[model samples]
Target: MDRPHSTSAPRVRRSRAEQKRETRDALTVAALVAFTRDGYHGASLEGIANEAGFSKGAVYSNFGGKAELFLAVMDYNLGALRGADWDPLAMPEASGSGAPEPSAGHDEDPARMVRGFGLAMLEFIATAARDDTLIHSLRARVQVLIDAYGRVAAAGRPDDEELPVDEVAQLMAALEQGATMLALSGAASIDSALLRTGLRRLVTPAAAANEPSPVRDAHASPLPDVERVRRLIRDTIDS
Candidate 1:
């Protein structure tokens, strides 16, 4: 007996919105890789689109242009940085959740992640220095992050901890940026112990709550030990 042949309809295509979201995600990923490798001025949208297997038209349709795309990539990297648990060694016991995972690559390393963020921040600073439009955009984004942090802090705080959430957020952001820049410059180095001590002072609630700070008193001490620590870091870097 001959079996009758039958055909089912082909699988349904993805919804237009799903397809668009996929495209945007792919472009974002490609842009991050490209920008990290080539830097802000060097990575082109056309190249990013090509790498993502999308057309340049697709990029234009999804984003306003290169600057907007660059900012989106910055946002993506920053989001990853925020998602990762920061190094427990850098904070007091109460402040630290856990040590951040070992980095699989430059994009994954916390220091390098902070460095990448610093570079993007530099771009924003440079643009804001000269352009009104970018200044406005930067201010709006800053406020949004601050407000978002305020909400998270409010939700997470215990009833008794009167945390100055916004100030804490600002200090953390500033230190990460400054530390990355300093590390990259190679002009000076901080020993791990000294680094941890320094960070703990700024990061823990005692200082973060806007109280009379130990950091203000600790600076009065001599730094012969700190200098030795700096030499060790330089030697490690040179090696």
Candidate 2:
């Protein structure tokens, strides 16, 4: 029997631009790993380049230096944190809709995602604190997150009943940073589910019954209760 001619098309070589992008992505990933393992001040461009199996020239060509690479890592990790796929049931409109949001992590474990990003963020913040230029840059990136939080809060409720956008953003930011500090201090008893759900509740203006919940027993983990955090935030503001 004559074997059918291979129908698969030949792979086209990547253009220079595409190859450069791949190299940049590889270098970024390697840099992130290296930064996490060795503190930012301790990590080197040479080490990162080697980790990516590329020459030190590739590091300079892609990121220019270690500071740039570290910022890139922060951008990637923070972007992921901000871009998490929140449950629709957590939405303000969920009160009228019967569709329930995923009880726990949605598609992936929120805890792991938050913890990893939080740790990296702490490291980046420490480095940025010492440098005036980097502090300004860090502030700019943080402003973006603050703006994003404001937008989400606006979407959740009517303008008349809506909380101050800045306050909402500040509250959410405090929760995240506090949780991150706790985890890093060996008190990781709290997980991301509580944080995610609590933020939804605080902004959505929905009754407790309509709030989305964890799919499994929340008590399974020793994490801080989302409701508690929500209450504290509310009380602090009201008081």
- CA lDDT, candidate 1, residue 167: 72
Q: TM-score per candidate, in order?
A: 0.61, 0.67
Model 1, range 1-239, lDDT digits (tens) per residue? 99977788788999999999999989998987777667677778899999999899999999998777866775764454333343423322221357353234521343343345456566656866687777776666666555544544444445565548777556544554455456556665443444445545544545445534334323211211222223333446559
Candidate 1 stretches greater than 4 Å from native:
1-10, 84-121, 140-163, 190-196, 203-239
* Candidate 2 residue-wise lDDT, 97-198, digit = tens: 664444555323334433444566677788789999889988888887777677677677555555687887778667666765775678664454556676
Cα RMSD for predicted model 1: 10.0
lDDT of all the models against the reference? 0.57, 0.64
- Model 2, position 144, has a per-residue lDDT of 70
**What's model 1's TM-score?**
0.61
